[model samples]
Target chain A: MHKKNKPIIVLLFLLPALVLFIGILIWPIIASVHHSLYQYPTFSDPGEFVGFKNYIDLFNKQYDFGKAVINALILAALSVFIQLPLALGLALMLGKGIKGERFYLSVYFTPVLISAVVIGMLWEKIYNPIYGIVVKGAAALNMSDVIPPEGLLGNPKTALLAVFIPTIWQYVGYHMLLMYAGIKGVSPELREAAMLDGATDGQVNRYVIIPIIKPIIKISIIFAITGSLKSYDLIKVFAKDAYDCSYKVPSLLLVRYAFHNAGGIASAIAVIMIIMCFGFAILVNWMFKERDLYGKK
Target chain B: MAKSNEISFDSEMYSVKKTNKFVSALIYVGLVVWLLIDLFPLYYLFTFSLKSTEEITGTNVIGLPKEWLWSNYLRVFKIGKKVGASQVRLFFANGGLERSFANSILVAGLTILICLVAALMATYAITRIVWKGAQTLNSIFMLGITIPMHVALYPIYVSFSKMGILKSYWSLIIPYAAFSLSMAIMVCTGFMNDIPKELDESACIDGCGTWGTFTNIICPLMKPALATMGIYIFLQCWNEFMFASVFSDEAHYTLPVFVSNLKGSNITDWGLVGAGLVLATFPMLLVYVFMSRKIQESFMVGAVKG
Candidate 1:
């Protein structure tokens, strides 16, 4: 709050949090972007500011930066596709009057309770070729001869996808809970009326339910997309020994660059990531402008 | 032929009419199947944590082991090695993850306590203070959610290091208190909105000051939201990997950092790792199981305000 005589008190209340946010968050973001201008040094400060050199380098696919960006986008898109649809399907199913719905919801959601590192380790051990569960299970099924010995995590072909699978799996119940809440809030009379008109289960879900829960869908998708883009911990843990520091999606990409590589380019990557996420968020919101569905219009 | 066709058609119609039961059963079956898929890895870890390494290697990964290693929990409490076993005092004691956990608790605890008080005071001003710029404060907080914490880590680290508090708890505690303000304020403001301004006015007219009025009137009414925010803040601090990872050393490692650190070479003690995970996850799970209903309701309440 601000006023002529009240400026001091107002500033007193406002200064601490805002000042820290600006000092710590905003300034670093600005500094991080600024840092991207220079040629990175080996063991010292940035040697000089070549105005667009790092940006040029990134654009020209120097250091495999372009690949990282593409990988990040694909990871986000893949996660959104997998996590949202499955979660939405579960949300719709459970939102139906299943007798033991809450129990199932909690049970399905237990994975979310554990740390990301643990999840990564568990899955990685399971995907270990020599002693992992999948290979052993295949051997047990007497199909070991038919399949290759390479496990998903070690195979470059399936490595990203293998990592992505758990990233998607972790959030299913979280998104399901969000979507279910949104679905539950919808008036059941609409569904009942649709059914009374001899509407099939498909028709009820398609015509009435989807329209009502569109915001939840958008919110869930936003989270899924953002989450996938920010998926670092799992991959970091899962790919512990084998993971090259630089070979990853952008969140980890930026991390590797900043921690191991210098700051300027990493800052650029960070800025680009924030923009990409916010841009995608805005686009989704624009696309799913469901005001009329919610009756606000 | 006509009589047989009629009989088949009637039976088919009867089956179709019972579709809800069929679908519900299918849903239950599908749910249980998915539950098995999702829970097996975690349940395996839990079971494995209770087993010795020998048992883990001998048995299938899916089930209970021959003997449960109940001592692993005790092992988690002590350091595997102490510095200079000839036992001289060192700059750091290489023992007691429980000590580091206590440090985390102290940092998170004090930070949250301060955050709650400060946010309560500031949020009151934003909602109840008859002045301009209130909207700006609120909007800044809403925008704060989108600003990634990593962006803030650099300056905070540099500044905290400059202040000679790099390895100290303040490195994390201050930033946490600072960064988590936006979330706390938003929730606090929302709770404040639900309590009508007339109560504040009446209290003011009766000679109560701002702090007194907040302490007496506003805080009590906001219990549900406060409880929700408390859990949110606790979880935020408890599971925080970044700030702790960057800021703290071995002496101050939070549970997340400890778990994150188990990825070191020669640290292939998956059994100990499993034990650590159970230790780290169980407290949060305990809170979740008891408070899931309230926590779920809290989100709905927040959505209404948003």
Candidate 2:
């Protein structure tokens, strides 16, 4: 309901959001690329331009960014292979018209609603070596040797798995809810038709229901992958220093360097993170599209 | 021949019913197992919060506390009192549990305010007005949904440090509002589309300027959408740990940051940290208990639209 040539009012309306968007998100990305190419010994002095040194230094033994990225990739793999399947199973089960469907849905989602910090702390107490349930239970069961004296989080061997368990536990409900919504949207006529052909529950879910929900599954995969790559909160709770930890991720290194006068290296890590997140997102989308076409044929 | 067919069909139905009952019974068992796994940790958090330090570290690992000591929760508020002339206390001086709780409310409140006003105006401009480049601007805002906040962290850290607001509320508020804008705008625009164009037309016919129409006609009808967006935004700001920890100091520490620091400063007090965690999570649990459906719906809306 506007007359022509009211550009001023439109600009006014859009300016605040656009400015915040660009300044906080867009400009930082551009600045990250620029800053990555320089050695910022400190923020005050944007020292001499050193082309790809910062990026290369990331792979050096000292930074070990390559390992961090690998760890993140492992987490992403776990989310897709382990976490997403569990979520889908739950969603499929709940979609079958259970008795307390709403109750189950809300209970499953309680973990996702709680902050990662709180979840991390809760898990930490559970993992506490001295009086933690893990040690106490192990002792009660006569398998005390399984846990190291320093605790699961203290040992590099088990720390990664220990940290990832709670992280995965917290978000399973999230993906389940997403897939559950998708399943709920499936028309009952389609299901009844499938059953009319004498298809069992497993077969209906595998062939009929899954094919209909591929797009949502694809979205969930993208989210799962991207979310894992940028995972920091829970992992941070386990690894306070970021360095000298087995469960290091890119964001941990990014934060450490950002405040430690290694801004160039931090910016490089940030740039790589942006690239990987966008890259995986595109890759997942394309892969799903290809499968859709193949299925049609 | 017809009687024989009916007899076979009856036998088949009986077997299917037996299998269905068995399968559903198995499914119920599985659902109950998962439900226990989900609720156990939360139950542990609450019970642990009421345990004494002695019980937490000694004889009582998993069971309920022998004698419930609510004093653990009281100690959570008195965190900074014992850090005498220590480096952690510099940041821990005013960094009590209560201070951080207030700080979190202020940061989250200001963020919601900023996002609502900015996103509402932007949604109006994009959906209602006939401006050149509106499509382009809308696309730019939409592009933000995919951009991870990590990309902006360091640069915003740099810029905010230079502006000398790195340790202030703006440090968290500005970025929180900015990061929240895309989803807020998306939800608003989605809702705004359903708002009939005739309302704006009638307002214009009644001599209402663009501003007048937005204030009088559109804002009131957008309440449900705004409420949905408000809860979503509140959760994001409240649970945010990264920027809150980095940008805010002891004086401005939010709940997540405060609870995290509680562990560090009070190393031996597991029960106290549990109390702090409970305090941090209590608001969210209350929200979940009351508006679990709305919270779930908000996330669903954002996901589908994104």
Candidate 3:
């Protein structure tokens, strides 16, 4: 408790985490940027200093990094527009003190606890062409013609959407729980007051609950977007052995290149991913702040 | 005139109540549909895991298996043995469900332990200690939350290789702990801020040293937050695939990687894959089932507070 020893004691406590944080996270980003500037293919040999060539090479067809970016962005968009709304709907619905709320919450959130690999495999079986649920269901309904024989994940055109479906489904409960917590934090008096003013349930939610939970919505948006950009596990399961898979996202590309001795290109993708994630986080916060001001007006 | 107004208002209320009932019914229906969709895959997973290979490959994908084959689970554990072998070994000499399960537990447990200690100390310092540059230190740690983990993947890989620790438990444990530190610190600090400064002052008055105060007063009070964080760090490490896949070789693959690798090799063996999936899934699901409230609270608290 000595005043002079305070700083030393604090330093002792903070040292381990600070060291690891710098060693693992902060240094890596710096290293990634440095690595990106060179033609470094692997760690053993420092390849030629290629300047911004790796960054430039990323957009070209040879790397298809541009396509990966576009795919990641598209996934981010779908997450915000499709996934968040569905989650919001569930949150709003369940936030109303419904019966079996805990049951529903656990059921929906079960996927979040399970490994993405398991979820991928589960969906893969469901989408299996021969004996999967899709084919069987279509056959039962006498609509087998509508089912894709090659399976959804196998088809290039449908692979992205198919993969995105499970990706989105896997986390619907995550965003829903976030919003649900926000919704529950909204005072009952506010809802009652709105109802006393002759507002409908929808009206009360729109005017009273939604505004109160806007901060949470913003967080969910940031999470959904950033999470989509960095998504790899489930997508990897779907990719398996496919070369140039249609659903290649930035993380996938980063992994592929990193393993294949394209360390510079991989670092470029990593830098881009970090940039996108941070950019989206800042943009979402800014958007929310701007909207808050407008709403006040 | 007053009676007429009252009657009209009552009628309006009745109609609104009627519509509310209808809407509530609609909402319940929607929730049930969502619930079914949410649960169906898990249901299928369990049922498929129970089915024989022939039935799984047959056209009865959605139906109950004619004869429930608990043997699939047995075979998952009995990796090198024949199906329905009388003497079943719990620990497979070959890398199978047991090894992967043990690996996942060890890696996740160590990661959580290391992360908690580091994060707790850092959080206590940042929140409780009044030092120069404390605010800046806090900001630096906070910045880690937004840095995508993949950015660190190559650097970490290269570093571990250089250090000759690649494919070892430390490689996974180090990064897992480091990556989780930001959020863990945020959660811990947020909780620590709530414990009144009076507690520390009182401890000091009792002639308690800083270490003593931290051990007796701070650590005890930190149980709930620590539990929440433990579940989180455990789940993150358990469910983690990216680092595990990259850092771990065959001998050290965690459950997720093991399950996925099984899928890759035994591409057509849905039953065996389902068994592997079940093995990977049920442990987490069991943890979630018992500790759902804690898990959910931790996730929400971590997000909201951060």
Candidate 4:
């Protein structure tokens, strides 16, 4: 295979597609880092140089960018902490000898398959304070008269949390599937040994199963973090006008800014995102070391 | 513990086994409760689609429809007529409702092809080429896996518009290829590593060149990974939103974009919208039903980000 002098033609074969990937995908990111240093001229025009001004505007020092950063981090942390473990527990349940695993897996996964628009609609109905089924369901449960009728989406206080519910619901199955694969990858003999040693199910899970599947758990958490950081579509549907005009996540904030007269600010946001994502990814990589397997989180 | 052995419980020892049963039952109960809550949302959609406006607009979405209407599905298709000019011209015009099935087929099909060919070619270089910068190319593509689609949106919008391909399927199809190349490369390259090098030497001894060896040798061997990546790439395109929204106009609406148009109509039809939701989600349903294993493997392979 070491055709030592294979004319280097192979490199040429890779050049075109590589160019597109590097040129469009990678270069824009690099360019965004540069542009963010300038001031956007207008929505359509390429921006002009304005050193550190936009970045200054981002922080509460001058702008409220800190709030957006705080909110985005909160949302990401919440998704990872809350969503990942719940999915792990559920995956553990099904990974055992659940009788109707296939049916239940499919049923649980139904939410992730639908359009984000439709998901927003479905939850919109459920959260409807007036006619939302949750209100009526609560009323039927006899906890009613004092309860206010309003979808969580309607309340500014609860809006972000309310939206987070659907976000968690929609993708839990994906994480569950990932964790399930992790559990499945474990060697069965060790589990049987734990059982033979008079270990109870809980002890087996605590000592053996969880430890074996820890890599997947870490991967699932990483997936959850990046996913929540990058989330825009689901929020676009559910949180449309749900938050104040100024309220936005880093992802959506940049997206809206990208469409304006000029996108210097948007470019800056993209740079921040790439840096955060890269820094986090590198952190994970370093944690995993060259082994590419993270032992446990 | 001794009492269970003394009683010689059922078969094996550890009469504490009943506790295990109880725990499993409890696990089932918890899973079942969440499953119901999780699935109940979909049932609400189903029931709402079956109901008249009065029923959905009623307080209980999951309540049985006053009357089940199968016609709601038909109405969605018919709503194509009034899908609106912005809606109609952008999507439904040129018979998008009719053309969508075919257009999506082409876009998805072509994207899958580009990803496969490009990734396979590049992966070979990563695996076999010891040339400098090959490793860098491999990691860059790997890093592309986590690069949010939104980050690339505006720059691509400006570029594609500048190229005058804005609103054409090429805009999406090309970008989709670019977006997915990293994952595809990582996957195929992993599989390529496990492929022994002797196969290539043997082929080259018979006068195969780079492209020739790829098409004749590697292409055939790469089919399994290619198939798995193909499905992932296809689903990504099928469900892609932001770019298809920003890059393409109404007439070029993909299925997800078309489904979003449900809201834009002055006269909103929740029933038809639900029906369309089902339609929009149909591909994934089919995938989960039949291709879940492959889909799972795709993600597992993709877990190795560049």
Computed on C-alphas against the true complex, the DockQ of each candidate is 0.35, 0.54, 0.57, 0.43
Docking class of 1: acceptable
Q: lDDT tens string, model 4, B1-306?
A: 122223222325543333366777788899889888887777777777777767776644577787888888776665444445564454445534545555677889999998788888888877875677778767767778778777887777777778888899999898899888988888888788878899988888999976788788888988888988987898788777777777766567777666666656722457777666766666567767787667666655676332
Give the alpha carbon lDDT tens digit for every residue of A8-114 in model 4. Answer: 66667687677769866887887677778877666456557788777767664433556667667777788878888888888878876468886787677667656
Worst 10 residues of 3 chain A by lDDT: A288-297
Listed in order, each prediction's TM-score against the native is 0.87, 0.92, 0.94, 0.89
In DockQ terms, which candidate is top?
3
Query: What's the i-RMS for candidate 3 in angstroms?
Result: 6.1
Tens digit per residue, CA lDDT, model 2, A116-147: 98888888888988878888889999999999
Q: Please list the residue runs of candidate 2 whose C-alpha ends up more than 4 Å from where it truly belongs after superposition.
A: A1-4, A290-297, B1-19, B81-93
Reference A-B contact fraction recovered by candidate 2: 0.65
Clashing residue pairs in candidate 3 are none
- Residue lDDT tens for model 1, B107-221: 8798788777767777877887767778886787766555666655544554576678988787887777766777778888887887898998899899886667778998888
lDDT of 3 by residue, B183-259 (tens): 99999988999999999999989999888888899999999889999988988998899999999886788888888
Interface RMSD of each: 8.1, 6.3, 6.1, 5.4
Best by lDDT: 2
lDDT of 3 by residue, A81-164 (tens): 999999999999998777898899888888888889888888888888888887788888999877677988888788888988
